[model samples]
Target: MHRVIAKLAGLTLLMLSALPSRAEEARQFRLSVPAEVAESGLMDYLLPRFALKTSRRAELVGGGAADAVISADPQAGTAVMARAGTVYALRLTGENAAARRFADWLSSDVGQRTIAAFEPEQGAPFAAARQQQAGPAPALDGDPALGREVALRHCARCHRTHDDDRSSGIGSTPSFPALRALPDWADRFTAFYVLNPHPAFLRVEGISPPFDPTRPPAIIPVELTLEEAEALMAYAASVAPADLGAEIVHQ
Candidate 1:
């Protein structure tokens, strides 16, 4: 009888302790941002549009307890406050789907116009492109030789482009042949500028480096047009993979 009563009491305490957590779960859909953004009325302007698009209400939490963070680019100067794009929070649970919807809406044409109108100078009016349907990946088409020319002009400073090309690029940079070797090489050209070697070596963004007037900068950012990017990808696809040397002899 005593054991049964003790078990009942413990269960009651457990249920009591869970109440606050359950309450928190009920009111979730919260986003986190810096105290400055929250206090400065940015959220006030953004949240209403957000609610309209997602058909959900979201509470903004200050001191960085948000599901998403809206902050200034660390590299951007005060004069031109470059928009660094949104950083959405990662939560694997299904409950956070509302956050995804909010993000999609922000990138949508309607959201772009609203954002542009909000800050005329910085936020240029955005017209969202039609969303592509999910299906088998489409084939990449471009002129490989033209791509090679673009690469030689822009990437050769750090990357070896061809077999006979004698000058090795930066120590860390892999040769074009080597990069093409990877199965995921296509991704390298998809958003090349935003990714690795480009981010670190090329396009450093914001203030341009002061250099000697006589000589060109050793490594300037490569800003490719749509045709150029496609060409580069085509050329990358054409290249033979680099031989990474003999397989490791495991003990």
Candidate 2:
């Protein structure tokens, strides 16, 4: 029994010693994205969130030195059934632990949802590692009128809430009607607040429409409960054009 315990302790020490010894490398996590995709603003939104969730300091690398690389399935075009996206862990230097944690998180429900929510201008929803049918839609219990009121009060400053009520929102932000026009808008709305960019930019005290440059920036995204999100979806749907065309998913 004593011999077995001694052997186990030696084995443990051997494994620890085998691990990479660069303290700086262990503290830094690096991810590489395809160049075209990197330019779409999606990775800008996602990579920071990845670091935040996994408690790591992540850096984006050009192509190599990546703890993980985000790539499309090579057989996607040729194979009838191919993965939507694949994450490759390079096990570079001393980043194995950080790499594994980020990869695991990417496959989690929250991570997959966030990944799918980012509709990059250059591509479609990401092929998540764990692909599952979306869960049942959240109940829309709040009043549509109340939802519109909420939008006018909170979202109008940044998003175009109505066709007539334009020229008020941030120039770059999408109009609510435009967003609802998408075929999968319903699903997208379900996870919007929990996804990147939204998580970073939304504030509880929604800035008023017509930019006031003088006010100090507010923290916390325009606060909307699940109930409010449901109502907002309903209101946006009501205003959306009946014949809005299908949007193409970028490859």
Candidate 3:
């Protein structure tokens, strides 16, 4: 009777050890993006592709503009999330072990394949159509002049063109600091802005459009096309502050 009772207790301990705890089961994560990007009808196109690719290992939950869903459960592997613009941001979240596994998976061949599969059908392709509709192409003869012209035409309204002596004006200037930090920053910045000209950060900063509907109206219909954005980035790069090199160090 003693031997049988001891065996039964050992079995109970083994079963309990295999069971997951409550904390492990209730993990959650939140991700946010610009509302305009969500409303622009791109998230719908991107979400399913991301989910299908990731669902085998992770549970893809809520997704929309400004916020997304990802599970924190150890069993639910890592989740990847992104927000749009020339300077896009992406994040991954999960338990330590699962997150590490997901990171390895993302860096692997299978992960690359999954990312490659995400087709922004309505975003990039639509932008190309709009570009075609716009009349004769401006001669991009590897000249900063073309960049300046593009900038003056599209971006001058929101940003400063020339260098200002006043510190106050400089503080308010929305310059392309990133371009000046990188090698060939001019060409890369121009290309990026020309491809996507939307002021994603401006909206968040309450400088363009107030995202909250409850707040008093500020700006209306805050969005921009890739071409318009590209023009702005290119122009900013052309006239970026000389001290941009120092900013990169801090970054």
Candidate 4:
């Protein structure tokens, strides 16, 4: 009889302990950001939109108890975004699907656009930070021929990869050569997988995180291995930048 009572007490304690966890699950996610960001009202504008899109609620918490913290400290974790020239990293200390969802949202097209659009009083809008790179960009190590073929297959549908392929590509999209003309073109292409539109449909095998089920691609999805993306970059680099220069003079 005593053993039965002890067993019942233990079970009751277990049930009571699980109650908080169930409550936490209902709350979804708890995130931490710098006080400056909270004060700037970016969260007020961002959270509702996030909830509407992902059907998840993210609550703000103090640093110690947060599932994730957006910090300027690189040692904290991986850099995810930048605001006003300050790079912020995502430091995830605990596991929560909603927390991961919020992180993905922060780096997604909508999140980036929202962050960039928010104009804080007397503050610069947030910007998408580039992928971390050490020193100058290395020289191309791919075959121009192979790069061209890769580019033709993957990129040409929306970008003119060559002068002979002028009939191809959407009018609104910039041509490969035009994009190559920009000084930061390499960086842009390197980070394309994580940026808007691409993240919706493009999966990079083992490199990219799995797509969120709550927000699947509206169009056909595309998958690429890291090697393929690299080859595409090599091909883009091979293109001659358009010489946008001197005005014509009629004598």
Highest-scoring model, lDDT: 4
| lDDT (Cα, tens digit) per residue for candidate 2, span 1-251 | 99999999999999999988766465567777666557767667766887776656667885557766665433221111011222222223333677667666666667666765676664334434232222223444557897898789887878888888856799888787777766656545554543334434442222112222453336434666556767876776677654556767899
Clashes of 4: 0
Among all candidates shown, the one with the greatest TM-score: 4
**Candidate 4, run of 10 with poorest lDDT:** 130-139
| 2 versus 4: better lDDT goes to | 4
TM, every model: 0.41, 0.43, 0.31, 0.52
Candidate 4 lDDT tens digits, 1-251: 99999999999999897776754574488889998878888889888989998888988999999888988764467656554335567877777878888888877767878866776664444555424211122234566677687777767767888767878888998888887776667655665665445666777666556676887888777787656666777777778888767768899
> Number of backbone collisions per candidate, in order?
3, 6, 12, 0
Ranking by lDDT: 4, 2, 1, 3
Positional deviation of residue 196's Cα in model 3 after best superposition, in angstroms? 12
Residue 128, candidate 1: Cα error in Å is 22
> Candidate 2 local accuracy as lDDT?
0.57
Please give the lDDT score at residue 246 for candidate 3: 39
TM-score of 2: 0.43
Each prediction's Cα lDDT score?
Answer: 0.53, 0.57, 0.40, 0.70
lDDT of 3 at 192: 34
State residue 128's C-alpha deviation in candidate 4, in Å: 6.5
Count: clashes, candidate 3: 12
